[model samples]
Target: MVDGATTGLFLDAAGMKALGAAIAIAITGYASAIAEKDIGTAAIGAMAENEGLFGKGLILTVIPETIVIFGLVVALLINSA
Candidate 1:
């Protein structure tokens, strides 16, 4: 076994804050990418069947990107504090 003092694998308050911010952004970005992928695939399929749906498909596909924007805001708040 190891001790905290000897191992020196601890995070101070600032480090913890940075880590939290990074985790928030990373997780949200990944989730948004996954959601966007599925939505984009569906949009493409719809657009293929009906050309008129191109505009709507594009808008729907981009909607998931809002998750990343929220994540960025959260990260900014975390770091600013």
Candidate 2:
């Protein structure tokens, strides 16, 4: 989008690289959130019925976070360039 004389984003090489990284991070966030949702509800429900399994259930619920960590690593790779 152009606002009169100013363009929305006139990205140079570095800016374009950053933009790509930002997009990758966003996608990673989405995937991680979805993954969490996939396992979290069931884990919580199971834990609610049986509190003894809290440790295992909690770890299982948070397992989705690994995707985000992988995404962070990818973002770091991009940022390093």
Candidate 3:
């Protein structure tokens, strides 16, 4: 059992854990979005120069998506703990 009086901010251990998980996901998701935007811009330029480069550009643009996936995994781990 936990005491409410001890946690003046109203968040207990579980609440803190949830907050931590959320922060992890939010920050990583934001970072991934920024990375995707930059990569997508460059990829679009490359594709414009050579249409055949579309596939490679697409793959490069999507690589940043892994950051979000990692973030989700981290959130899951944090929440589970």
Candidate 2, 1-81: lDDT as tens digits = 434443336765567678878887899899989988878888888888999988988899888888888888888898897
* Model 2 vs. true fold: TM: 0.81
lDDT string, candidate 1, 1-81, tens digits: 544553325776677788989999999999999999999999999988999999999999999899999999999999998
Q: Taking the tens digit of each residue's C-alpha lDDT, what string does model 3 give over 1-81?
A: 768665638687788888989998999999999999999999999999999999999999999999989999999999997
Q: Report the Cα lDDT for candidate 2.
A: 0.81
How far out, in Å, is residue 77 in model 1? Answer: 0.4
Query: Among these predicted structures, which one has the highest lDDT?
Result: 3
Candidate 2 vs candidate 3: which has greater lDDT?
A: 3
Once fitted onto the true fold, the runs of candidate 1 whose alpha carbons sit more than 4 angstroms away are 1-9
Compare candidates 1 and 2 on lDDT and give the better one: 1
TM-score, prediction 1: 0.81
Q: Which stretches of candidate 3 lie over 4 Å from their true place?
A: 1-8
TM-score for all predictions? 0.81, 0.81, 0.85
lDDT of each: 0.88, 0.81, 0.92
| Candidate 3: residue pairs that collide | none
